[model samples]
Target chain A: MIKMRLLNGQPQNRISMADRAFQFGDGVFRTMRCTGGAIEFWARHYSHLEQDCAALGIVCPSASILLEDLSRLRPVDAVLKIIITRGETARGYSVPDQLLPNRIVQLAALPAYPEQLYQQGVKVRVCSTQASWQPALAGVKHLNRLENVLARREWHDPDIFEGLMLDRDGFVIEGVMSNVLVLSDNILSTPKLEQSGVSGVMCEVIFDAAVQHGLQVEKRAWTLDEIKQSDAIWLTNSLMGLLPVSDLCGRHFQSHAAQLLLSGALKQLRQKEKFAIVDLAGMTKG
Target chain B: MIKMRLLNGQPQNRISMADRAFQFGDGVFRTMRCTGGAIEFWARHYSHLEQDCAALGIVCPSASILLEDLSRLRPVDAVLKIIITRGETARGYSVPDQLLPNRIVQLAALPAYPEQLYQQGVKVRVCSTQASWQPALAGVKHLNRLENVLARREWHDPDIFEGLMLDRDGFVIEGVMSNVLVLSDNILSTPKLEQSGVSGVMCEVIFDAAVQHGLQVEKRAWTLDEIKQSDAIWLTNSLMGLLPVSDLCGRHFQSHAAQLLLSGALKQLRQKEKFAIVDLAGMTKG
Candidate 1:
């Protein structure tokens, strides 16, 4: 399937040597989990992609075209990555007068999840690495992720699990690649991303779930002390769904309310969430 | 000449879909200018590239191997770019236990320089964008350069010229891609890069020249307020050599004792500097 896919896309592989994305880290991407026979959160994923592309003034490709291309590699379920970068430029910073962003989408097998760890949440710790404050680029999932790369490098403990990151101002931001939610005073609260943090897809699901269930929700600057004192804490992401924080540096107390809410939501969603196979040949090249 | 260059040691026609450079910005690159068949400052360029690769734990191709690829290009004088990225990762951040970093050496004709602008000097302005302080990555030239991209995006005023960047704490650091030196009270000073900024090769030369010419040379933190009062300011880089800053925003400066001494030394060295290109085929690829 992979060989044939490459052979067919040969004609559409005309990337100019001076595209700004290749020249500068000017792009955005989305990695969707296609399970069963449908794309998980397809609307939300493309919405975020288009929003970010527009924020950076890059042209976006049509979603139906992308869907058409994805129809070729149908094999139950797979992982799909879509990249849209600032298009060709004549070796300069100013985005050209007329812009047609280059879009490249690729497909791969879904990574096997560590189901054992998910049953009993993995050990989590706080990382020393801090994301710099940049309101100009806050919230949207842009391709400039060196902060996450550096944070991901902060740990090598195989026995350990996901680590939380804080901003330079000491505000607990989010996880290495996931979103965080705190159940404090019976309220669902997450850190605000006016300065920095990837606005996550899973996070939107959690928020919507809270709204439908009539749970009080809040979004604002959150400190480490506040998070530790919260009745319960959980991490959220499209890949991991939702995992309750069982142990934070050995201060273990199963936030009874957190366990109830997180478990209930995960159970309700997992029952409906399914992955689909992607057809690589049908993918459109921007 | 570039089309013949192979990808992954094969006669590939385009960049691979799985190249890590495209996926994660996981790479390091070096660009050098060759004049009259010889690459100026080859040793300095190689040293900086090697140090960065070592710091990032990226594999380093031997100088001989690099030259062999260069010899294949056979350009009398050209702009060469060397990009070595974690080649074919399987769609995740975890670098494989056994990884083979890919090496790409591209040669292009050099663009014409504005020598007259150098002779008359140029104007520069302080950019609103601030550089994030990453202590671990302060002095190395890695592929992650969004800060430079953002700062450079501030203007295209050919007359406005380069923009100076300040650290989060508002300390004068350097230009978008060049280092700045200020002269006052018969002393020449540049900002230290222990916390941020690329330690430019030209900066080291100017520091040594200051000592040889009997001028006080300083490297430490100073605010924009201090820089505004300097008698003379200049920008230095491997490509631009040493050029004076005639106008900084609303402020104008004239030649000073320290800049005079530094300029005189650079002029004499350029006259005596011997540049000889070695056969690229002679380079080793360990």
Candidate 2:
């Protein structure tokens, strides 16, 4: 696979040993999809990155600078990962008097996923690892992702595509890498992420699309029992778009109507001029 | 200042961008003081590192291999930092089938501290940021330390030596970078770290020393109000052995007898044949 990476806006594949990201996981990152030389939902990704950086007191690089850096990779169907770290420090938790934020952008070949996963959906298991409830750091895609890493380690079977993680209080929060959606009685609801979980970009797009389609959309806390009783279940993220959960903890979900509706809306959004550069061929069809 | 670093037992100063430590904070680390070519409490530090790595399912490098790597640094008065990451993986959280843990060791000039900090103590303030409660990760010095970074960011005053962080329920846990100890009457108490906080190596040594000295010790939950009513407070860490907290949230403390007793015990420990290689001149005298 062809790999292209930039560190501090320069082509480089290595970072200093003292980089805060390497030391304390003191950073935030965005995993975006890039196709035909343009990024999918660049504006939204940038906005979210700004908010996440602000939450951690990091100075985010301007969109123009990041765009220039992305352009260095040229046109490609790839996974784009951007990491903004608080840069190198003199070996302590305190922010240095003179701080320089490190920007790392890497483009790699798009990961191949089994087509059947999108077409027939996937089975997911509940993870024993509970997400920590840190309201101060909740909802931001920061580098402190040990919880997600640990939760994802709960299963090794290729048959299971994702693991659902609950908060310390046993409230269903999110999937290991995606935001969750539950549809029941014409209502589209997702977990409230104010206490835990990352607020995924695709989840926001789905919420907006649901609102545009005259659907009742709600962001509230739900229990695992409530999730099992939902008519349909889906997971959303930038790379995977929307993946319906055919089986969750032995409770099978049959309805794909809500997933189809939201994915169709996302497809339409991709066709708009702002996102026209995205190559649909690069994405797996559901 | 002379600096020496090793990556996976080889001389190197940079790590691949794909290192899990940089991506997901998937690692554990230890910070120790080196004097006259010998690491302070090497056995305890190694034991803690092994336990921490085991907790995160990362294979720890053997003591002989790590000792050889440290030997490359030769005899020096410096600070030693060791990081063991789960190495790199294909673009996700799943652990790779064939895993190789990355061991990084770095030696740098010991940080200089004011003699007054050890003698008269330092002032500290309570941080507004609350530490997250992850029982699985509690007491282990794993790399998911954004909470500590955020808490350290809460204070910028040079006079304020450290910030005390509370857990989710407003119970005082530990300082941003050190374990806390409260002295009230004849009792020496520290927060129980079963819920949150890094169990500092020096804190453990102090606990053992207190017992040897016949001082009554207790480990339990404490609040800011209780901290204010304490006779004296102190912070302990590997680098900064122990420093009394003269002021906390405007409440001043005058007793230094407890601090002296503990420091004296540490001095005796340093005199042992096993620790004879340590250089007493390099430390700040209380």
Best by lDDT: 2
Q: Could you report the DockQ of all the candidates, in the order they appear?
A: 0.28, 0.67
TM-score of chain A of 1: 0.86
Candidate 2 Cα deviation (angstroms), residue B125:
0.3
- Compare the candidates by DockQ and give the number of the best one: 2
Please, what is the TM-score per model? 0.87, 0.94
Q: lDDT by residue for model 2 over A136-226, one digit each (tens)?
A: 9989999999989889888888888899999888899999999999998899999999978898888888888889888999999999989
Assess candidate 2 and give its TM-score to the true structure.
0.94
The list of candidate 2 runs beyond 4 A from truth reads A273-286, B273-286
Positional deviation of B46 in candidate 2, in angstroms?
0.3
On the 0 to 100 scale, the lDDT of residue A56 in model 1 is 67
Residue B16 lDDT in model 2? 90
Worst 10 residues of 2 chain B by lDDT: B277-286
lDDT of each prediction vs. the true structure? 0.71, 0.85
Cα error, residue A153 of model 2, in Å, equals 1.0
